[model samples]
Target: MQKTNNLGSIKRLQREYAAFLKSPPPDMTIYLIESSVYECHFSFKGPSETDFAEGIYHGKFIFPYDYPKNPPEVYFFTPNGRFAINTKICLSITSFHPETWTPVWSISSMLEAIRAFMLTPAAGAVGGLESHSDVKKEFAKKSQYYTCPVCGANHQELKKIFLLENDKKNLTENIEHQLKINTSSTEVTSKLSNYDKTEYKLENVEKDHKIIIEKENNNNQQQDIIKEENDIITQNEINNECKEELLTKIENDEINKETKEKEEEINQEDDVLTILKKRQEAEKEKIKHFLENKEEIKEETERNEKYTVINETINIIFYLSIFLIILMVLNLLKIKIIMYFLN
Candidate 1:
């Protein structure tokens, strides 16, 4: 079911597009590019004797992917005009086209809407009308005479086409209405001039305001980007500092470990020295004891030798005793002589 509807939509678009190509509207020059079927460029002259009369303007009309189902977007190419670029123009027919656009209304009807909409002001619209009466009038003069490059025809062809295609009663009435006109031409012109001046001033002020807003937005975006970049740089610097500190700490730890090991080794050497000093003191005590025992042995051996000699001499000693006593008495007498010798 969906496929069938899709095919139907395709057929309708193709049919509408074919009809438009077969007979394009008069006065407007349309150029269709082969690559994009929905996009077209057009050139048209402003309406005659009016403010936008003589200007040769270029514009673009872009059909959405949906084409005739939705209204095509229209935008002016030239900047030297009252209306802004790509500003949407409102028309009763165009607005209602989505629901009420019949196959019966040809491309010519749409073109008429374009023309009429350009003449009217689109208040509060982006790229809306802003030209002075004098400016529009001057542009209108040139618009009427300019030739459409695509069609190789002038705008007079358009005016003739409009006169022929439009309601005959309105046209005939408009001519008679001109004859019966009561409003002074100068008064209307003066009033139009004032209106144009006011409109132009407001539109120009709006344009300036929009430009300032766009510029401020761009500056804010740039500042945000710069701030982000600065933050990233600051974070990177902090990370680098942390990494450096960690490396230094690691190196210091290694040095401390080496110092600790060396201190431990020195302590072990001091323990070994203390053990050697205790062994040396024990050896010296043993040597001193051996020397004292040898002295005692010599004294005992001398006493034994004196006992044997006394026994052998006992008999002889009896007779010698008396002699010894006399010798002792003589020695006692000689004591005074010994003492003198000693002194």
Candidate 2:
């Protein structure tokens, strides 16, 4: 399992290397160790914009088992007169401080930070050895002709190759940009036609939505009269879920803000998708309950209609029997009166 995890880092390194080749750093050349990828060598040009300008610096990068998570140990191989040769350069991005290391910080990032740090006065610290400015300038002059035995290339040659690759990369980007512009021009007319069709569909959908909303809102209002108590309860649940989501997002935002501030030391990565997934799952359950409550309400409404119909039919029959009785009594009274008159 450990080996597999290490392999993940190695594979990632391989991909980073390929990407570096396509877009190589301006004044840095990195080469792999004999057969071990974990150890690599780099020749960096002293940033021309600084006092160390034009000084070629050779360095070694040694990776631990947990690379990326742990920044590599960087050591200067050449006596650039900045720090003692073969001395490790201590910076925030180095193995000197694992707490600040982040997997997202690649080898190029490390080199860039180191290059910037080299411009600072060394002060003869544990990892930094300060030197005279004139001596450093002389070293810069000498750095131009320095060659690495392992890489078998001089500084200028490496710099030439890097610039060529950079130009090619830039040219490729320009070509891609032009292709996009050309493709967009052709797509413009089609997109305009598509926009018209979509506009028609959008109007239709909006009308449909209004109709559906009106119908549902009307039905729900009527149901409120019938099952006002139950609907109020279910509606509260839905409102609570919405309120909870709103509050949760606000709280998460606060937490994220705090986390960002605090975790700067750790450089932790957050899984935003995971957070969203959890919230979505919770809301789905609430929706399921809401729908279930609606179904129950509908079933109850059907039962109520059936009961009302049966009661109305019984009331109608009772009234008809009472009218027949009253008519019979009146007819009997009329017959008795006629008999009395005859007697």
Which predicted model would earn the best lDDT?
2
lDDT score for residue 194 of model 2: 76
lDDT of each candidate versus the true structure: 0.59, 0.70
User: How many steric overlaps are in each model, in order?
Assistant: 11, 0
TM-score of each: 0.35, 0.45
Residue-wise lDDT of candidate 2 within 146-234, one digit each (tens)? 78787465777655554554554555575567567556645754666777767755666775576567557655654544464355447
Residues 137-183 of candidate 1 have per-residue lDDT tens digits of 67655555556454244556545444443433344465455434423
Residue 256 miss distance in model 2 (angstroms): 45
List ranges where model 1 is wrong by over 4 Å: 1-14, 86-106, 140-343
